[model samples]
Target: MSLSIRNQIAGTVTDVATGGAMGSVKVSVEGGELTAAITKDAVEALGLASGTSVVALIKSTEISLAAA
Candidate 1:
């Protein structure tokens, strides 16, 4: 797939929590874990689950970039 965002972090899905209309996805990365809150439909559409491999794409108007 193609993407314009570059701050992609490779990680493995650790947990998935879905409610009425929102869902939370937790991914285990190199240093730690990150959680993303998204729509429930999106969660099902992507078929995310524990042990699933995924990429965390970060982009925002207030995004800060620093050398790591």
Candidate 2:
């Protein structure tokens, strides 16, 4: 089986709440190195949770990254 590996920055779920009809996922990457806000539905679909193990995909084409 071929496994799809995404370039992810591992972090913790900082917060979670409702956004109108959708939800929100705030993850702190790299020891609070980076924070990203994702949709709650996507979080639920991905089975994400507070203190849950997650992968933050680093999309090169769409977004850029920097060294801090």
lDDT of 1 by residue, 27-56 (tens): 999999999898999989999999999999
Collision pairs in model 1 = none
Using all chains and alpha carbons, the TM-scores for the candidates as numbered come to: 0.83, 0.57
| Alpha-carbon RMSD, each predicted model | 2.9, 3.5
> After superposition, which runs of candidate 2 have C-alpha atoms over 4 Å from their true positions?
1-6, 31-37, 65-68
**lDDT string, candidate 2, 1-68, tens digits:** 53354466778776667665576667777656445566657767877667876767666565776898
lDDT of each: 0.92, 0.67
Q: Count the clashes in each prediction.
A: 0, 1
Residue pairs with backbone atoms closer than 3 Å in model 2 (clashes): 23-40
Span of 10 residues, lowest total lDDT, candidate 2: 1-10
lDDT of 2 at 32: 69
Quote the positional error of residue 62 for candidate 2 in Å: 1.9
